[model samples]
Target chain A: MILCDIGNTYIHFCDTYKIWKNLPDEINKKELSSDVYYISVNSINEKKLLKAHKNSYNIASIVNLDTPYVGLGIDRKAACLGVENGVIIDAGSAITVDVMDAGNHLGGIILPGLAAYTQAYRSISPALEKRINFGMDFDELPLNTQSAISYGAIKSVVLTIKEIVGDKKAYFTGGDGKFLAKFFEKAIYSEMLVFNGMQISIDKALKKHKEQK
Target chain B: MILCDIGNTYIHFCDTYKIWKNLPDEINKKELSSDVYYISVNSINEKKLLKAHKNSYNIASIVNLDTPYVGLGIDRKAACLGVENGVIIDAGSAITVDVMDAGNHLGGIILPGLAAYTQAYRSISPALEKRINFGMDFDELPLNTQSAISYGAIKSVVLTIKEIVGDKKAYFTGGDGKFLAKFFEKAIYSEMLVFNGMQISIDKALKKHKEQK
Candidate 1:
């Protein structure tokens, strides 16, 4: 089976559930001939996916949105899928903590990502450019304006997620997922959550296809 | 008695507890002989205070910063002094929510102001400069990226504050005070909170000065 996950910035195509970034060019050279192809895209950049399959023959296909479920932004959906009853946190360009219970998806909170918050204050106030530090102590009194902004933004998101999730299992994913996982004792990190969800969807689709035949 | 309250942005001097901003220069010039100049500067440009009193010969010597308070931002100190017992929110370039109970003061939360959030995203990604409306509608989604950011940042702060000060009286102040006040159901707006805090400080200082004599 071939799986493709498209995001706001980059596209990932993988044959197996390991790191795709380290894959060799030979993987790209293979003719696309899988029983089922699962594709996910958030941006309008479908051309990248089309180019990859240009040399391949026609095959069964399944497409899905990259959020809230399979093909969804794995950062969010995986958190939702990973925990049957808890909070899913995706801390990347932005920090999103969503709560899911039973089958219903409770709303989540989104804040400026840690680095994004620091970069933001620096850009707007030229005076604060030299003072942006992402990993500084938040509880200590912020020494300058830039530290104040960064520390405040980070703490705001952390505290908000903690408040909503309470004692529930907190699942962390995305770019800074592992980094934020340290803050919460209940947090669990699964790097390929989005990919895993996509794989599950592909398996389900193929099973249904065979059953129909 | 001449009371001068210096804040982070402006200096407000008043003879009584009335509207000082709209007071005529002629009134200040004529009746203010300054037997005792009660001056309070809450992390503001001190030079402006000196310039204002450069020609006031009867200024029995300006006394400042001799209070028992330590390690608090001038704006926060001012806000705490202004409110009786409630959550004092200072919404400016950043938003700080300080809680005061009875005569003692409790610590608060600090985060980026609304404009700072939008400006940060706009600087990093110029494509998000379009104006966007913010509300509780998850179905509509954010058409322009800027609205998505503004909605996220504003909602984060509001929700956090609500969690912090549940069922407590809330008071809003600062540059963006009015804009933020609309988010809370029972929040009271005080445009001159810092100045009022300054007044309280001045009163305490004058009483101390008189007792010392």
Candidate 2:
């Protein structure tokens, strides 16, 4: 069985312990012979894959989790499912901070990612335009404009995450997850968190189908 | 003496206890006989005002403070000058958080203002676009997208300030000063902080001119 997570840019596939990615256009050229379960944010790409492959399932359709948040992204839902009790952080194009306790999604907040933080500063004024130093020391206040903005971006996000997570175990995922996880006293960095979530959802769906039969 | 703070959108004039604003275009139509001390971010408008009035002085020239921060805004310099020790927050197009202690400028960081925060979220994705509810409760994790983004913006900013200002008093100024000051246990909301800084600079400049003679 193969699990997939499709974003606007890339279509990621995970089979067992192996993971690979393909462009949306590349989906039509290759034949997906095995059963593929996928969750996608890109509807157009999802439709194209659905048309090309007969043995494909949109995992988002089957994944069920307890969440009070209305219109929570399927990707976030999948990530939350992988953890029973922890603060799940998905730091991609946007950084999402979700809290889960006793196997239920408590809710979450969204912050601009590192790139988005840089873009936000640049958009405010030309003087504020500076590259964010992700590795800047948060202990001391920055004395220069570049360091100031950089420290602001990194520190603000770190503080927000720390405030929300509290004593709960933190699970970090996505592109910049490892970088942010370094600041925490203890955080689990799992690259396949979303994929693991997809697997869990697929398992639950299959079990439900079997019980129905 | 008349004091003016020129920004991109509006020209704010403070005369003693009275304060008023004028559009950039309206400055030429009005005749000014009084000596105006002004700090401006708008160069064209500053030059135009300079040409129109010979008695006008750019207050940025006279203000002297101890700090290592480079390219700091004149308005921020003036705000810092108003307080002996405190975290000065200027919430306008961009929210600036500066730490001042015992008459020395310790440096500061900048974050996107409330409006900029909204713009940042909207720019991330179409689905993420929502009006930020500024008054949302921060104690609980937000269950809806609107509250989530709003809470994230407010809570992050508040936490950053709280982290930096620890035991020091907080001095809030600018357009959204009063609103943000409510979050802190004890904070001074001074509308004339920048103007006061300008006045202090003018007094110092006059004293130096006397000493030279």
In terms of TM-score, which candidate is strongest? 2
Q: Where is model 1 more than 4 Å wrong at Cα?
A: A1-4, A9-17, A20-84, A103-109, A127-147, B1-87, B98-109, B118-155, B159-171, B175-188, B197-213
The regions of model 2 sitting more than 4 angstroms off are: A8-11, A20-36, A42-57, B8-10, B21-35, B42-57
What lDDT does each candidate get? 0.57, 0.83
Worst 10 residues of 2 chain A by lDDT: A24-33
Error of 1 at A145 (Å): 3.7
Error (Å) of candidate 1 at residue A128 is 4.2
The TM-score measured for candidate 1 stands at 0.60
- Alpha carbon lDDT of residue B163, candidate 2? 84
Looking at model 2, the pairs that clash are none
- lDDT (10s digit) by residue, model 1, range B1-213: 655544433444555564353122223444445632433333223454444455432221322222233444555666687666788888766677776777556555566667777765554334444343555454433323444455567666777677656788889976677877787888999766765666666677679889999
Interface RMSD of each: 5.7, 1.2
TM of each candidate vs. truth: 0.60, 0.89
**lDDT score of residue B90 within candidate 2:** 88
